[model samples]
Target: MSPRLVRIGLGLWFCAIVLFLLFPLVFLIPLSFNESEILSFPPTTWSLRWYRVLFLDTSWSNALWLSVKIGVLVTILSLFIGTASALAIVRHRLPGAGLLYGLSIAPLIVPSIVIALGMFMLFARLQWLESLTTLVFAHTVVAVPYVIVVVSAALRNLDETIERAARVLGADPWRTFLLVTLPALRPAILAGAMFAFFASFDDLVITLFVSGAMETLPLRIWNDLNLRLDPTVAAASCVMVAMSMIGLGIAEFARSAGLRRLRMENTDG
Candidate 1:
């Protein structure tokens, strides 16, 4: 085929894949606005009643708040642990770095249900199920891999000479990291934070096994789905989708700004 034909074929293929992935969302968003309690497609009427219920109902609101709280906690923990792990593996070149890196990302490789079952057994033995702290830590186990991957990639791309220059200028290791390295890593860290939060917020399988009486937003949605096809669940899902998009937008903006700043710095240098 001609090069022009190849390019057109590739573009068409990409468009098809995108449409295939978004086919569900195209239906979901509309169904969320359906006036009827039933989750039928192509709504006969449209209303925001379900959205109102999602906000006004204490159960749904409380579950959302709990999920947000846990997500934030998990994000912070993941950043701390994952960044340290990445620095050790990528920057310091620690002994057994390969093994450590594998261990760090092991959660991603392991099936979530297997992890959930293991956690359930352990937490049950400790009588720690349903604890907020337990949930945060459990979520953190899965969320940290995202941070490690992002920070490790960024660390690899980062100019080591900048850090070396800071050290040569009489800055201590701690000061160099806090001022020079951390600022450079802001974009990757933010992106990782977004991923970590979503990992916790959308987690259901592990939460189901470990949460016990505690209800995060996903658990609440699952419960609703099991009991009835409430339009409220659809509304909650739309809210989550909106939040995910908003988080993605913010992360993309930060990444772009960081890249522009890096370019400007390079130009100045």
Candidate 2:
């Protein structure tokens, strides 16, 4: 094909791909605002009824709140475990390092249902069922692998020479790590934390098996959908989508800024 023709084809392909991905979301955003009892294409009389229902219902509010709390906790927990484990795996030479890495990433590869079943049985044995503690623990276990992957990538790009220089200048290993290494890893850590938050917050399968009375948003949404599909659920979904988009926007903004900074640095050098 001629270069001009190839460029035209690629442009059309990219636009088609973008529309395919985004069209559903465009429909959904408007459909969520429908005042009608039923969700349908080209919804009638868009209003805030569903949104009002979401805010007014104590059960929904409480579940959403619980999910948020759990998500934040899981993110923090994942960052701690994942970032630490990533450093251990990537930076240190240890016997059976490959085995350790495999173990660390095992939860990600294992199906959620399988992990849920294992957790359910283990928690039942320990009498930890129905507890937020157990739910958070399980979520953290699953979410941490994301943190490990993100932070490890970030750590790799960070020049190790900074840490070495700090150590040579009479800084102890712990001090050098705290002041130098940790600072360099911040953006990646934030990215990992965001990933962990979303994973735990949006989780349904694992939460369903492990949790009982303490209902998270995903569990409540699942239960609601099972009984009867409601427009309110669509509203809630819109809210979740908005939340995710906010996070996505932040990540993209960070990436853009980082790239610009890198370009500036390269130009200066």
The model with the greatest TM-score is 1
Clash pairs of candidate 1? none
Model 2: residues with Cα > 4 Å off, grouped in runs: 255-268
Residue runs of model 1 more than 4 Å from their true location after superposition: 1-5, 256-269
For model 2, which pairs clash? none
- Model 1 scores worst on lDDT over the 10 consecutive residues at 260-269
> What TM-score would you give candidate 1 relative to the actual structure?
0.93
Per-candidate Cα lDDT values, in order, are 0.92, 0.84
**Cα distance off (Å), candidate 2, residue 233:** 0.3
lDDT by residue (tens digit), candidate 2, 1-269: 99999999999999999999987787777877998887787986979888888878998889889999999999889988998898888777667877988888888899999999999999989999998789899999899998887777766666678789999999998899899888777777777777789889899999999997888987888888888877778778888888888876776566556555545644755
- Cα lDDT tens digits, model 1, 1-269, are 99999999999999999999888788878888899988898888999989999999999999999999999999999999999988999999888998988999999999999999999999999999989999999999999999998889888878899999999999999999999999999998998899899999999999999999999999999999889878888889989989999997887787777778767876866
